[model samples]
Target: MANPTRRLEESESEGFVISGKDIGLRMKALEYWKCAELGLQSNPNCAVQSFKVVIAEALPNQGPNQIDTFLSEHGGPGIQHIGLHTSSMSGTIKKLKLHGVEFAEPPATYYSEVGRLHDILGVGQDVQELKELGILIDTEEEGECSKSPRYLLQKFTKPLFDRDTFFLEIIQRIGATGFGSGNITALWRSVQAYMNEKHHPEKS
Candidate 1:
């Protein structure tokens, strides 16, 4: 990845891609990520706890060739992560691991944080299991003094292709809908570190 990726709303696909400013491929390629997300979460009535698609593109001025491995292979300028919803996150993860899929490690202190730890236990999730799976849990609180809050569970697989350009995110949403700011910084830093190490090794 030549530049740090910027979040592009789904609405920008048509106009942004047509401008041909750094973004590679075209309308169809832009549509492919959305299509791919839908394809991954195909079962509508699987009684899934939660799932949503988040799309993004590269920020300009970093370098000339903007297209990354994911864009050239599975997705387009839509680099970053793809969140797939599954009813059974732990089960799915175990199965994926059995097949040799590796996931990104969360910050070591994630589960030790008081608020986050409370959220995990409040939701009745297994602390050890979550820690072992490297899942990050977040809550979309309801106002300051609201009674109930919704939860979001997520984990990102390391980039399957070379150089950390893209990855798959396994997300389970239980009445919550925020990209999860709780752990976003950690996630962002990991991606940036990978980009620097792989593309600008000297700076890294």
Candidate 2:
């Protein structure tokens, strides 16, 4: 097990990376986001309910050393995961898992304590449903008074070259109309934890 970031850096140093093209794609994505905003503002009934994006290290089947070569040729820093919206996250997760979809394991506490938090935040979702799917919920503030319910569901597996790439996130929005800004930090923390475990299995 090796640190994924460290591995990426090492690969770069070894002249096997994709840097420039990745940057170009990111810039393009930013432009797309801007345009999407404008389009949404212009048309209220536009098809903007949900969208999915995947950002991951390039897959091996894409080419021999394509990921490394691409990263080496370009200053690689891009998306490596996708988010899919689902009417029923539980059903979706179960089906995806059955179909060989991999997921990252969030801390058990994320599942156990989220229900109490959801109740406090007044979110209208079934906590048990989330738990059954091994989803994790997070909020920005801690303690009794804070009541904003934003959550992150993560799962991990060795795919696309013995490296953790794609992950599935199931989001059920009640009042929020966009990605949960408050829960990002928590998601990052969970990712870091997964990476650490992947890099140091002995410790686990």
Candidate 3:
């Protein structure tokens, strides 16, 4: 007739780590024991994934005008751009550029390294095609001699202008999904730098 609660408290004081599965099992056991004491049935499926709660932000709250006004006064929104997915990013970028679209300057070395990593990872992308169409690419893979995956990420962005908003983005992916998280950071930094240059022109 020892106190189970006291034993658990002692175990925690001794730095005992419990796995998630073990905690779930213990909770189920406790529920079963309580049900038995009350002459009731214990449902084992109560711990299933179907009971998880998922929350999503509403779209109206994130409308263009609302976001723009918020950022204009608060020094650019942390999210400087949105990515648009396409099958041929290179071709899309080229066509857009020809139609007077503007883009941030992507580091040439970054593009080169991404291409090399993509080749090593068997991603089978067209480097020359990308070059001819002026698309920028970046990947998480290190390189051929590195111990990491060759290339598991890619990124692209295009700016759009309308009466309602300053810019939007056009992105493409072959083996990836969603916006490249760090890529957005880098793009935002670049935009800030450009704004700084524009406000305070360099002395010749």
Candidate RMSDs in Å, in order, are 8.8, 11.1, 17.6
Report the lDDT of model 1 for residue 7: 30
Off by over 4 Å in 2: 1-45, 48-75, 112-116, 119-121, 138-168
Better of 1 and 3 by TM-score: 1
Q: What is the per-residue lDDT of model 2 for residues 69-160, given as tens digits with 9 covering 90 to 100?
A: 33443456544445555556567678877997756555556544434454534555566676666664433333365455544433333233
lDDT of 3 by residue, 145-176 (tens): 55543332333333333322345556654433
TM-score of each: 0.58, 0.51, 0.44
Better of 2 and 3 by lDDT: 2
| Model 2 alpha-carbon miss at residue 33, Å | 8.9
C-alpha lDDT score of every prediction, in listed order: 0.61, 0.44, 0.40
Q: Candidate 1 overall Cα lDDT vs. reference?
A: 0.61
Task: Output the TM-score of candidate 1.
Answer: 0.58
Candidate numbers sorted by lDDT from highest down: 1, 2, 3
lDDT of 1 by residue, 18-122 (tens): 223233322222223334545556554433434333444433543333244346545555555677887688888889989998777776776786566778888
Worst 10 residues of 1 by lDDT: 1-10
